[model samples]
Structures are given as structure tokens and as C-alpha cells.
Target: MIVALTITKFRSFTIPFAFIGMAVLRLPLWLNKRCRFWKLMGSGKDAQVDLPADYRHWAILTTWDNRETYDDFNFRSFVMKWFNFFGSESFTILLNPLSSHGLWSGKQPFKTQISDINHTEKIAVITRAAIRFNKLKEFRSNVKRAAEAMRNATGFILSAGIGENPFFDQATFSIWENMESMKAYAYQSFDHSDVIKLTRARKWYKEELFARFAIIDSWGSLNGVEINTNN
Candidate 1:
């Protein structure tokens, strides 16, 4: 499957349209024939679990049927027109889903795939969740610790926090040197493990989606740093 992440930082004068465009982009995202699942999100100020956010920046994550289909929309679509009209800086990332579990909006966007990650592959993992209203405080409280743990985890490369709405629709996208290293962080880290356990016991998420992918390619900047394709 095709998973794409587009991040755009609107010019100060164009911020209003960026706000409006995010709401307007939803229709075409769902209506598009090739798109399977999509989310329009805001970004945290740092590349980890963060509280303060930058209203000037936004993100869009969508799953498409194939690479060519995504390319067509990326290069030629109403959404692209909006980006051109209202965007200043934008980055688009294309990925291949190696495996996925759980759900987003009650549906599993990516079907289960075998654990075929190779030793040389740079693994990309994404976790998206819509937090339950009552659990917001707890979720936020644990974020700093979890972010710290992740940042310090072995083989960790990079990561960022994103969401559709503040404190509610939250997600994290992190890169690892390989699948094994990612698993070690997910399963062995006490801080992360505690957060995961609390998520289940507390029922923090109203809906959630977890996915793993093999990095294909990326362009432009995320949080002002260019994506490193070789890593």
C-alpha cells in the first residue's frame, strides 16, 4: 500500500487559508478513488511528544492504492492546487507499508504483512491515536518520559509528534536503524512499556492505528531539517 505524509508551513499571511484548507481538503481525500484512509494533522514544535504546537504548520497522512495513483494526485489534484495557492514550504514522503495493526476510525487501513524487514532496511514506524477525552491529562503526563525514552533508545534515528487535533488526535512517526532495534524500544524500554500498558488499562485511545513501513523516499523539510533518504 502507499502511505504518504505531506508537511507544509504556510507563510504568515497565508496561515488563514492553511487553517481553512485543512478542513476543506478532507472531502477530496475521502472522495478520491485511490485513497483508502487519510488524516489532516497539526505538528508539535519538536520532533517528539510535545505540548506546544506551531499553528503555522500542518500535515496530511493518507494511504493510496499504489505509487502511480498517489503520484497523480500529488502532482495534479485539487489538493495540490490548494497547496500551491496557500503553502510556502511543503514536504511529501512516500512509503511502503511492511505491516500494520489496530485501526483508525474503526477500520484497519493496512492489512497484516509478514515481518520481512531486512538487516539493512531503515524502518519507519507510525502510531496514530484519537485520545479519549478523560485520558488526556494522563496521556500528556506520560509523554515527556516516553519521548525521552524513545530519543535515548538504541538505534533511534529520528521522530516527530503529529495530530489532527491538540491533546486528542495524536500520532508519532519514528525511524530506526532496523526492525530489531525498533522492537527493542517498543518492548524493552520501561518508559515506553509503561505508557503502552497504561494506554490499554486506561483505555486512553478512542481509536488507534499502528503501522510499520520500509522507507522509500522523502523530500523537502520536516521541522526545518531535510529528510535524509540514505539513512
Candidate 2:
């Protein structure tokens, strides 16, 4: 099923550029080399826009075949190299089609489907971590497990890197089918609960942010889209 991935960062000029130079440039190359990588997911027709000055970083939106493909890419490429490079954070939100949609300067109204589910539910998972320099490795490990659990859970659609600068603490975004599925894995699942417990017990993060949104309207590329003003 096609899924949407969104990567955003807090405000910083140098940090985002560094990510562009390093992670962004290498990502397409890495995807090309990977066995399960699909086509680049984005809008080629429109000119890319700059992130607002008020915002720290821009959001990268893309689509994938399924959660498995996305997970493989993350484990093999992103977690190993990309995550370590920039102090970035991300949140992923799963989107279901609300109505017939189309792009490319008004073609016929494309018949829309959820791609995963029927309802138009969009859940966003946002996580940020602050770890002691000495415990960075440990923090990374824990976060990795949490991410993996999230991937394994049912109703997962897409997950992405959060911020542009991740040297100190990092964030991640994941999309889920519904709040119930998200809560089941995040709050009830065994391994995931352990990760959460460790995060709190060890004081791994200085601060974290999380919120959920229902997709009201979406336009643009899969890697990035313009959410509706109503949302």
C-alpha cells in the first residue's frame, strides 16, 4: 500500500543545509541500490518551495509500497547513516483518501482509495530525545527498538526522520491507522512499553512532542503535501 512519510526539523539554517548536503543527496542513491526501493515519490512538476523562516526545517514527503519496504530502507540505510549525520527529527502521518483526487493541472478526478483502510484517519507520532553524550549509543538503541516496534505494529503506514540537526537529540514521525492501534503498540505492547519505560527511567529525553491529526485535505507530492487549512 502506498504510504506518506513526512520529515521536519526545528528552526536552524546551517543544520538543514548540512542535512541536504549529506543525507538528502545520498538518499536517492541509496534507494536506487536497495532491492525494494520504489520510484522517487514527489511532485516533479512544481518548483520546490523554501521552508518558512518561522519554521526551522522543511518537511520531506514521499510514498512507499508498504511499511515493510519503508522499514527495510530505514534499518539498512537511514538508521545506520542518515540518523547519525544530522540532529534531525521527524513525524509520520498515515493518510487515507477522503474523495476523488488528482494532480498535474486538473485531469479527471482520480478515484480515491484509502490504500490501507477505508476511513480517513491520520495519526502522527512525533518523538524527540535528549541524551547525554556518553549515553548516546544507548539512547539510539532504545529509540531504534521503539521504532521497530512501531513498524511491526498493525496499522502502521509510514515513518520518517524528524528534525534536521540530530547531534544532541533526535525526533521521529510515524503514521498509524487509528489511535487504538497506536495506543495498543505504544502503551500496551511489551517491547514498546519497555522502551517507553526505559526512556522515562533513564531520563533519555529532555523534552518530547506528540500530536495527532485527521487528514482533511492533502495535495502535492507524497514526500510533501499541503495539508488543508481546516486542519
- The alpha-carbon RMSD values of the candidates against the true structure, listed in the order shown, are 1.9, 16.1
Please write out the lDDT profile of model 2 over residues 196-216, one tens digit for every residue.
788778876555544344453
Model 1's lDDT to the true fold?
0.81
Q: Report the C-alpha displacement of residue 58, candidate 2, in angstroms.
A: 6.6
**TM-score for each of the candidates:** 0.91, 0.46
Provide the overall lDDT of each model, using Cα atoms, as 2-decimal numbers: 0.81, 0.46
For model 1, how does the per-residue alpha-carbon lDDT over 155-187 read when each residue is reduced to its tens digit? 898887888786788889888988888999999
Q: Which stretch of 10 consecutive residues in model 1 shows the poorest summed lDDT?
A: 111-120
